[model samples]
Target: MGFKSLAGKFYAGIVQKQIEYQRKNAVSLQQKIFLYIVGEAATTKFGTDHGFSDIQTYEDFKKRVPIRDYEELRPYIDRVISGEENVLWPGTPAYLAKTSGTTSGVKYIPISKQSMPEHITAARNALLNYAYETGNTSALDGKMIFLQGSPELYELNGIPTGRLSGIVAHHVPGYLQSNRMPSYTTNCIDDWEEKVEAIVGETIKEDMRLISGIPPWCQMYFDRLSARAGGKKIKDIFPNFKLFVYGGVNYEPYRARIEESIGFKIDTIETYPASEGFIAYQDSQKDNSLLLMVDAGIFYEFVPAEEIFNENPTRLQLKEVELNRNYALILNTNAGLWGYNIGDTVKFVSKNPYKIVVTGRIKQFISAFGEHVIVEEVEQALMEVARKEGIDIVEFTVAPQITPADGGLPYHEWLIEFGHAPYDLKGFALKVDQALQEKNIYYKDLIKGNILQPLIVKSLKKNSFVDYMRIMGKLGGQNKVPRIANDRKIADQLTRYITN
Candidate 1:
């Protein structure tokens, strides 16, 4: 083994032990992080206003700080943007993570110096744990590609501001810099297509081994690479390629197509990362559930998914969460976000070491007829049908069609782009609809009571989603179409690309 591989294996062993220790004492570790964050930020303006100094226990903290979203916390964030010190965290923030918001125009999530390590360390541990489990550290010696946003950042009131991925680009560890592909100059291109072209040109002939990014963008990269190589599968071009590290979306929907592009199935690591914090990562390949980051610099709270919008929701700490129950994830991070609702829901699959599966976004759901169908249910339904029928789905989204032009009962509409169309398209749609009904009781009830009709599947022209995203100026990076929406904002626009 080379020096890099040897060093990686050694580090992986150490981190594996540390992770085991943290999992064993998850509750105590969370308590320590809670106290530490509260103590560290006790003198900040937000802390003073919330009486953080007087907060003695979880109950006290809960009473003092109410749960808040971006809008509710905007006043303090505004003060920070105006160059105020000690407004949110101690002193000034190290950086501001810029992200698109649904209600708010653009959200600026503070990333304090103290909190920055949480992001970096968790990412590092993800790969290290992979090595520990699989006994594969050769990727550390080969080229690695991370398809992400442009690293070019601008200052917001003296604080570096950019997309979370771009901000993270600046902090790539020194050892990995040499192995990382696509030159810094190429990575700074503002236009995503141009940037991908640059990346293809830069890394096409290199020893590319590890590829990481959100699924759709990675699929785009794979397409570009294959076209450049005269339709060669990725594995043929880069024989050493392995280890696909991805987050932001579930990999099941895109897995078949992604594997086809590569010409073979490869190992993958799923992660749950957000602007609020690096929450969890898949620790074992055998177990698909992500191990929650209990020892990370964040304290977590869970509110039953059903009670998320309640005036007084039941908030449970780490030790209190039950298995198989959907909970809205709340965070109290070292970045000075107290009682913060991150808008994601999770279901615990295992409570022994706190492993969870991301259910869906709290806000992104279809409930037009009071049938509250979530992303997980929809994805699961489609995956079941696709797997059974051997269909290749490029991209898809679900929205309620409240008004039908044909004067039929309103029903769910699925806009799908198929790489390989199903032979029995209607049968495929019916199977997916039946699967969805099985997954959601409310949806089943609606179908049974004739309140809603079986879903309609509209085949979208190839590259329709790409075109939509391009038109919206969100072609690449971490941007993804919502899996399900209550309204037709996205579905209506997508109609223009419906295959005749």
Candidate 2:
């Protein structure tokens, strides 16, 4: 093994012991973090306004602080943006992570100095945990590519504001800098297509071992590499490539197409990260569930998914969460977000060490007719059917069709772009519809009662999603196509790309 691999192994051992301790004492660690954040921010404007000094228990905290989304919390965020120190957290924020918001045009989330290191550390520990678990540190000896946004930042009140991925690019450790690929100049390219082309040129001749990105973007890079290599598989282009690290969207939809491009199965790691915090990462090759970061300097609360829109929802702490139930994730972090609803929903697979799976976004679901089918259910149903039928799906989205042109019952419309179309499209649609019915009872009831018809599947031309995203100015860097939307806004525009 090389010197770098040896050092990685030794460091992985230390992180492994720490992981074990946290796993065994997950509740206590979370409790300790909760106390530390409250005490540290007691003097801040938000803390004092929320009666943080008078708070002594979780109940007191819950009663005083109501759950608020970005728009509701904008006043405090505005103060921070206008150059107020210690308004939200103690001292000034290190950076403002700019993200596209739905209701609000643009959101600038604070990344505090105290909370910044945890982002870098959590990511490092994920890789280190992999090395320790599998006893394979060879990936440390070669080039690694992280497909991400531009690292260039422009000042927003002199706080180095930019995309969260861009902000993170600046903090990559010195040891790994030599192994990181796509030269700094290439990464700063504004256009994603141009950047991918530049990246392929830079890493085509290197000893690439690890690649990381959101799945669709990684797929885009793989396609370019194959084209450049005169139709050779990705595995042939980079024989050393072993690990695929990804987040931001469910990988199952793209897994078959990606593996086909790679020409074989490969080891993969899944992570749950957001602008707000690094929530979890896959710690075991044997298990797909992500190990939640209980000790990552953030306090977590969960409201049952069904109750998310209610006037008052029950907020359960880490210790109170049960297995397999979907919950709207809430956060109270060192970044000064109090009772903040980050919009993502997660389901706990293991309560002992607090492992979770991202279920869907709180707002991203098909519930127009009160049959609230989520992203997880739709992804699972479609993937299961596709695997059985020997089909490959490139991309897809579901939206409720409230009114049919022929005056038939309303049904869910699935707009899919296929890599390999099934021999019998009608039969394939039937299987997927049945699978979805089995997964969601509300949808099943509507179908059985004749209130809704079986879902209709419409195929699109190749690269339809790519073209759509490009047209919308969201073709890269943390922008994912919505899997499920209650309305037809996305579905209507998608019709123009439909195959005849």
Candidate 3:
């Protein structure tokens, strides 16, 4: 295929346009970038011919606005739902990506007409760059299977609003049609019950060459497939499959179990997709870090990790950012989001400005017992403990709770899943405790000769976490079971079979 007809050229042109814009406005890049975004926002609402007539300068807009979350835009969302015009960007929102809000149960995130192509292109760039870097263009010619959310679309007052996957399925490049499986007509997102049947009955027949989704869902599908095939391996079921792409959450915990069940070692690609945008994705052969979609209709901002939730946090523009420094991401996108904190923390692995490693969520930490444990620290400790014990882990989550101990309440609890049964659970826990103590001063002070002791390891059944998510109505979608819970609420729910 010619480069002009390929998606890569289209994506490269977009990147070049961004670089040109940056170069032309080099004198006051920040102000010019903000002004351009504001102009886009204003023009969309009024008319294409009219631009930011109300706002003239960056300082004028900055003083008038404060950082706002989705809640602050609830009214606009309501108007969109009501089918009222001029509430949002003067056009009907093409699709609404249902996302789990931090405080709200579920939020319908509107994707504007102008920004849909940007989302599509960013996703394409992720794939193209992966193929270019890994020399795996052959995989693109093979069938691609997305073990994603249901293709079911929900109608709000006769308007479609549901999974974004459904929208993507309908709109992918036509040239790629020959390589797609589950033809567009039959690819609708059905409910979980239907999805399970489809997977076992029909969808698996595509001779799927590439698999994609959260690790838990991927595990669930394989389990069902294996069960139906009378304990047949993944390779036996689909001999053509070559790679597994997953993201939205850490894949390390479930890595061994997936390989064990599939009975083969497959190349893996990780992605970072949020309601705001498709942010980053791993190259096909690259395992170290994900490359950022730098030209994907967004200008990036980063706040130092230490100052993420501070009262007065300062942010760095893209040009001023450095590699290997942990920072909380904030974005200003063509989708009309400005200085929006997407609630993800990441660090660049290379000076290329595009490759990064997703450390963890901004608020996902276990500090209830004054341990101040972050995901990186916990993952590092677990890796070290596993190395020392010669055991592999399929999936694991930690929950800390206070139990009555000698004279007062002390933090006492831990849960883990093993790839192979350990020789001594208690001994392994002690080593992990010691490792954590050396790494975290807070844990050290809290456990210094105290009555608090490491609890027993609650060995979970194989694919137990996937089952838990299925029970919670979060299976086969973007929702993922929490990897680290500070309290016992989730753990207790998952462990209902055990008596206290």
Candidate 4:
């Protein structure tokens, strides 16, 4: 506690200065950050193409770079991967983060030397903000175990490539690596279950104070630890554990189980770290809204989610953004990604303080037959049912069921695993259908027109999602269930798993 108190005090001071800097000139600081990145890489092919030398202001820069997605930026990234100098950034990209959030296949994203610190600093400040806001520094004193992908690098072209978490783990600054755990031996285990077992064995006796991971995987860790320790709760095993940091999924569904595992509640912090960069984090103690990472070497843009697929969508910079509207996120970063759409949709929760809530992803949906049910609608519907029935759900995914014959009706198929199952499957399915119909007019219209049948709800055995993810080789760390898929690929796989 003494060591943590001192470190917290030091880190808090740095955050307060950041707080002041952000508070004073958020929009202006973002503009300057953009210019600094452009100026540094001005002689590069991309910079030259975008008229980087003539761009003096946000308005000027906006016209030069057209908003794009990963496919659109692949050419430049390919050049960088081939060891071409000054293709995008001033020098070769130090690393590439291969992520699958946008599709079933991987998207190769560059991590330039300039952008690497953005990841580290954003994470560091998230902790600093927690300490400053709550006046609790004990977490800094003990082992801060981060459950992330292994740091082992794989080669693609001439560059090192891995998941973003693995890359971050590899680049952990010299000062914090010694204080972090599990042992290097355990951390390098590529298999998630094996890693969890090793981590539990290594960490069970340590004076651990902080735990960070995606919610479901961390829940699994806590469950394993409790079972190994004669069924005692996490607090009984690691009594000093005071902070739980989580992200990479919506925390609502798994929160209660995690708290129950711990035997009590602890301060929880949320962050929005994508493969591209750290987007936002929980900076206040009072609410769930995340503070935007404005000055972190990333220039931000937002296109109204409704307008995203339009031929010529309006892309709004920071100042033009309005609160409470869903917008697809875009980033032009020091990483040399220009006008790239990272595919996330976020709604501003607070304009005066600049806070946001990640609503869903651009490509995640069940739009079969033009019903167009989005993740937000599905989550809200499930959440409503959970609240009404007093049952906890571990995870769920949706896929459309289309009829092959004219006499048959098309419908939705749901694969759900419950933390605690509800007794009435029929009634529960009715409620969920009603909720979705209420939330989505297209869905209701389809139902009213007899274009779609009532949704089919299938109860999965306990740990079904875990097993499904395990089979997919994505059982831990930052991996998450795809909320919705247009086709039956995910649903079909889950069906096989459930039957067996």
Candidate 5:
């Protein structure tokens, strides 16, 4: 395949130069003021359009614009559907990306033309940054496949809209366009059965090198590919494949199974993506943190994680944030979101102002007993225990359930899937218990008195998680099974065999 089909090498080069420049000069006084102005301007527009005309200055904007949840924006969404002139911004919304929330079954987040460019630029920068870091820019010489949601667009009258993926795929450089699979048009919204069949059929015949999308869907595709090829590994299906880019949910649970099916530890890159924008992405070889796209037309704020659940919370400016501190993210972006508490928490591992680790979702924490344990704490505990035990865990989830002991205090029951099962399951459980004790002293104290005994380890059958997701109607798409639950609903559903 001809790699350099377009003379647009300049675009890539320019992005490279900008990345270097921003790395060295991202936190200067000028950059700070520029970001402040951008944030204020975005907020002003957001407020004015939403009937807060008095929000002209920064302080006024801050006071008048309360942090909005998606439910609060339904009125504006209705206006957009009615084809109002200025429902979101100055122009009509070009696209509405559907995303699900805890309360809202499905939401259509309006995407304007102004927002599309930022998504494209951030995505391109992420790809280029990976290439620069790994010295593998030519990886694009082969096909890059995204196992994403149905690419269909929906009309106002409920007609099948074409695939949104195909629409975005077309925007890539023409030189690299041929490397896309299932051509966007054909992949657009079709019948679910037909879409899966087409994706699987074409993927098996193609030279797919780079794969990207939600982890659950990718696992489903890998299973389909494996079965189609008569139990062949994913590496055998795409011999030239080297990278697996996943985001939208935690990859820890699916990690072991995916590597086993692929027959190798494929280079993995995680991202934090949403319908509003692509917020952050892990680099080629970095496990520390994801680098934020500073030039992606989004200004950010950080509210201390401790304050997120408070009645009166204080938020920090980008300049005021520190490394290793968990902060609930607030974004002011070109997508018409201003001071938007997108309900995600992140922690900085670097002070360069552009790199941070996504700790977890704000609402995804397990606090049934008011211990207020976040996902990061659980992940840390798991990683530490695994390291100490000299084992590799593929996936795990913790659920809070009541046992018959001591009048029903909430206790944690862990479901862990290990790459290699230990001969002594009791010892493994003890190590996990000790690790959690060290991280969370309260849990340790409770364990000593038999308030929460070390729970049983229930090893899942091969591909059990995948089958469970399939039953939930969340397989083969954007929906991801949560890694930590406040209650046992999902855990019970996943662990029915063992529980029985």
Candidate 6:
């Protein structure tokens, strides 16, 4: 058999086991995960200090380790960086994923030897699940063009650190590596503009079969590829392109733009991989919900989104979460992230198979006037408006314009970068305003009470967000335009450089 067939069979076997285990029983899965983690990490300092030795049950485990975010793990991570062994896990981490610190400067997420394989396995299974469920192996026979981050890795006190996609890229098996595009040299380009040009030159004529990356960046690539083809859609450039694997941000708003770039509809698979670990993925082509990776070397916990910011909040285990409620994710992974808050919100859609959809980031919202507009709501509103007005937006960001100097009442300021501008800009903005009012009562109340004025919409010059991300040094891969800023900090900054 060919290697692709063999690999397909191998991935099929593993994914089958996963789907079966995923549906076996939530309680049993959780128990097994707890035992696996404690057993593997019991020798580590953090584990032993937290009484992993005597922790025979979930209650015991939870009682010992309080929930934490990256801030709370700073000391331990610092120790690990300083060459400490077994600080959080059984041994030193193989690498640290340098995540976007737009909120906190930079976050170094440890990827231990034990946990790295689980991540790879989970990623592998995401594709395998898609292939198996669809009964299509054409993608396996063709090359994949993963629009990954910089492939360059840097060292921090003897440990490797870089974007997670970059770190993971270095480890793609030799067989798959041969089928990958953007050659290692091109992937290492640190500058986004230069890198995309180089990638366009390299893969525009290649028999690329799959494309994967954050939606905004992918749109940039597709646009450039179309330009290279003399205005032909990206599908003309890559006829074999079958699957578009994406994650890290909402895809709803970008779907129309991406499909337009593709010249037709295409299959897509979504992943929920945080810097901490691969959490969940779209397992079936028939549905939109993602299946949780229940057996993927991570113990899961959930805290109701409403109570997550409170002084004390109840943490709910896997089976304890109800359907259709936003909950913040917590993880106790084999990587030694003990009860760590990943900071993304999700809502369950199914219990029989434990399916979920990512809602938004815990910190990614606009709430300057108590009108808490979240990512999901804003994205849905944008999509709804775009559909209504026949407009195509490349990317956008919203923030509260709270400077009373502009007007007495604060208003939401949107800086929208468009691929195709609407003929009726005013009507487009009005539709978004009405849609958001329909979705968020607090925002409606603010407008009704005259506490906030109507939203201010600014059409940005093409490539505004692109230029901004390039300036911030966070252009490609999982990096994306922040949908909502806590204040006008980012909005004002972008406006200074990109007024249309």
Listed in order, each prediction's TM-score against the native is 0.99, 0.99, 0.84, 0.95, 0.86, 0.95
Q: How much is the lDDT of residue 297 in candidate 4?
A: 89
* Shift in Å, residue 162, candidate 2: 0.4
- After superposition, the stretches of candidate 4 with alpha carbons farther than 4 Å from their true spots are 101-104, 154-158, 404-408, 497-500
State the TM-score for model 5. Answer: 0.86
Measured on C-alpha atoms, candidate 4 has an lDDT of: 0.86
What is the per-residue lDDT of model 2 for residues 313-389, given as tens digits with 9 covering 90 to 100? Answer: 99999999999999999999989899999999999999878899999999999987789999999999999999988
**What residue runs in model 5 are displaced by over 4 Å at the alpha carbon?**
5-11, 25-46, 49-60, 157-167, 184-197, 284-287, 386-395, 405-410, 417-421, 449-451
lDDT of 4 by residue, 366-444 (tens): 8888877988889889888887799788888999988644568988988888778788887898899999999999999
Instruction: Please report how far candidate 4 places residue 355 from its true position, in Å.
Output: 0.8
**Candidate rank order under lDDT:** 2, 1, 4, 6, 5, 3
lDDT of 5 by residue, 171-280 (tens): 66665677877667546644444566678888897888888987766776787889989999999999988888888776765676788889998887887767767777
| C-alpha lDDT of candidate 6 relative to the true structure | 0.84
RMSD vs true structure, all candidates: 0.8, 0.8, 4.5, 2.1, 3.7, 2.1
Mind giving the per-residue lDDT tens digits that candidate 1 earns over 205-251?
99998999999999999999999999999999999998899999989
Which scores higher on TM-score, 2 or 4?
Answer: 2
Model 3 pairs whose backbones collide: 150-189, 151-188, 151-189, 152-189, 253-394, 292-354
lDDT of 6 by residue, 1-500 (tens): 35695678667877777677667776687788889888888888897788888888888877888888888888888888887899898778899989866655688989988778877888888888777777666777777888888878889988999988988888787768778888889998877778899999998778888888988888888888888889998877888788899988878888988998898889999998877888998988789899898887889999998788887788888989999999999999878899898888999999988999999888988888898889888888888988877788778899888875754778888889877888777778888999999999999999999998878788999777877877876777677777887877678779865654
lDDT of 5 at 410: 50
lDDT of every predicted structure (CA atoms):
0.93, 0.93, 0.67, 0.86, 0.68, 0.84
The alpha-carbon deviation from the true structure for residue 136 of candidate 4, after best TM-score superposition, in angstroms, is 0.8
